[model samples]
Target: MSDYLPSIYTKFLAQFPEVAEAQGAVAQAVRERTPFDERTDRLLKLAMAIGAQAQGAVKSNVRKALQAGAGLDEVRAVALGAITTCGFPTAIAALGWIEEVAEAP
Candidate 1:
């Protein structure tokens, strides 16, 4: 229900309210079960999104990371560090995606 949620995702949630509720519950459960703090969790998700080469996920995680108090440098470091594990192209693309959210006013 966040205004910042992508329109497509909002529509999907609206169309499948029950599924959305279940998905939200699962996400909450995972967060509660995780040992990592919110900032670390978001940063790890950002790294995974970079590895998966998912632009939207990368951007979303970047925003979440920032909200969780991650510094800009920390976000950039995660993307840059992916170059060795995820390759240069994936890292570069993720950096761009990070910028899209990080630089937004």
Candidate 2:
């Protein structure tokens, strides 16, 4: 796991190992079903999170995107680009979520 991931997330995965394994398998299955490369897939997911105005998902996806080698600028662009379809408030809120992960140690 990336160092930027929140401790709560890691602890939850640890505390619920079986569920975490299941979720990991599901994530791998989804990745296998995708034609997009890892970086592209992660970026698209981040964009979707932004559009959905899901703060936690935004943070998670931002961390995943960066772990998959996306630049912070690319992540920010995805959130900001959501403004057109998702509106300013949603995108702005998502941007904050992205920053929370992107700027983390």
Candidate 3:
């Protein structure tokens, strides 16, 4: 629903409205079921995205985390902490994506 969402994602959402609605419902359910607060949830999502090597997710979560009041250092820390679990290259790539989003106007 964001204007900034990637074109491919927007196209998918447009092409499969039902699927998009279901996905949104699932995401909402997860948010309601989770014990973590918004910022923590965003950070956790960022970590998961990093582990999955999903650049789009990493960038998206960085923006979401910041919007949820997470600090820049906190965002950077999440990417840095992934190095051990996700390997140096993946972590570095995630960090680059994080910076790309974080530095964007």
Candidate 4:
């Protein structure tokens, strides 16, 4: 049992002490598998961030994406994919995130 599960924020952390443990277990269970490269995952997450207009998360994930193996062009394509699913604003935002990461040291 660790601490801090996303679900806990909306749930019984105060009422049930054991809920914290359970939530941590759930998070850990989901986190244990490193099924894909982290950078690739970050790139995908960045696209999600764009769709949600979560600029901070997008910016952070873009850096992680570049660190993983995501190319600028690849990131752009991902953004384009988001356009079909999420709309143009999301796609453009993702592109901006990619560009920001590309410019970073």
Q: Quick one: best lDDT, which candidate?
A: 1
The lDDT per prediction is: 0.90, 0.84, 0.90, 0.69
TM per candidate comes to: 0.94, 0.84, 0.93, 0.62
lDDT of 4 by residue, 1-105 (tens): 112233544466667869778888995676567575666667667777878888666666666666677776777777788888988877787787667667755
The all-Cα superposition gives candidate 4 an RMSD in Å to the true structure of 7.3
- Candidate 4: segments with Cα more than 4 A from true spot: 1-30
lDDT of 2 at 42: 93
Ordered list by TM-score, greatest first: 1, 3, 2, 4
Error of 2 at 95 (Å): 1.4
Q: What ranges in model 2 sit over 4 Å off?
A: none
lDDT at 39, model 4: 68
Task: Give residue 58's lDDT in candidate 3 (0 to 100).
Answer: 88
Which of 1 and 4 is the better model by lDDT? 1
lDDT (tens digit, per residue) of candidate 3 on 51-70:
99998888889889988999
Best by TM-score: 1
lDDT for model 2 comes to 0.84
